[model samples]
Target: MLPARHRMRRSADFATAIRRGRRVARPTLVVHLVLVEGRDDPPLVGFVVSRAVGSAVVRNTVRRRLRHLMRERLAVLPPGSLLVVRALPSASKVSSADLARDLDAALEQATARPRHLQVGRSS
Candidate 1:
């Protein structure tokens, strides 16, 4: 479980990271997993639950489920990476098993590596 501050905080940060960060994205019926390497340990995982996905409570439910999944599975991920798991509209209608399967698939794709860069280079 990463601290709140280290998590992606702003829309701009989310947009920027997704736009520019090299990523491995995979889609499942329940969620969309987009991951990119980030800073050192306590690797952050962000959840995106836009209105297109669900109502407030529904969105929060998806976020909580995904967060729990991350907590349980983060150990399998490489250190110093950022993972963003976006809830698809279908997430609101899925069971935990469905979410878990989607998450597992996404996690597999996210963790596959091609050699990540250090946080800073070309200084």
Candidate 2:
């Protein structure tokens, strides 16, 4: 389970991350990351499992699994970072290990190429 302090509960935060964060997409999930400047607080993580993924029970299951997966990875994130993990319909059928791999790959890409460092952006 994810701790309350590290959980992202605000819709504004979700919107900000989705709209302005660095995005990395994988087969089963998409990760959006925003490195909030200078706050040094714990990283905030949220999940999105839509009805397209499945019915209510499946959606909740996906959410819970994603939440559990994120708990183990919270320490790797930079301080004050905002992250949103959106689930694709394929996520409903994927195994937990595969989900973890998708999450890992997405995070690696998101962190490795932040906005300022991308091609054609002045240092």
Candidate 3:
């Protein structure tokens, strides 16, 4: 679990970060992942679980698994980036390792995709 200070709790931060950050998405056996790039030492990651994902128990379980995976993979993620993971209904049935694999793949693809903008350009 993220420390109290690092956890994403406010609606405004979630909305703003998600809106501005770039995303890479992929489907897993029981969940979906959405990763957005940001700038923190161990990359900030959030899980989005709505009523559609499952009941309260299921959602909490999934979140716990994701949080564990995030902690395990923190060292490998790009430094100073924000990643938001959105869980699909299917995720209620998958294992933690499977979710980790899905997250890894998503992050790899996100990092590999080309970005259209360059800092030095002028119109």
Taken over the whole model, the C-alpha lDDT of each candidate is 0.61, 0.87, 0.60
TM-score top scorer: 2
- lDDT by residue (80-112, candidate 1, tens digit) is 555566777877787888888888876676566
lDDT of 2 by residue, 19-81 (tens): 888999999999999886756678889999989999999999999999999999887788778
Query: TM-score, each model?
Result: 0.72, 0.91, 0.71
- lDDT string for model 3 (15-114, tens) is 5446655566667522222233333334556678778888999889888887877776666555544456777777777777778888888766665642
RMSD of each: 4.0, 5.1, 5.6
Candidate 3: the clashing residue pairs are 30-90, 30-91, 31-91, 38-80, 38-81, 38-82, 39-80, 40-80
The lDDT, on a scale of 0 to 1, for candidate 2 is: 0.87
Clash totals, every prediction: 0, 0, 8
Ranking by lDDT: 2, 1, 3
Best by lDDT: 2
Which portions of model 2 miss their true places by more than 4 Å?
115-123
TM-score of 1: 0.72
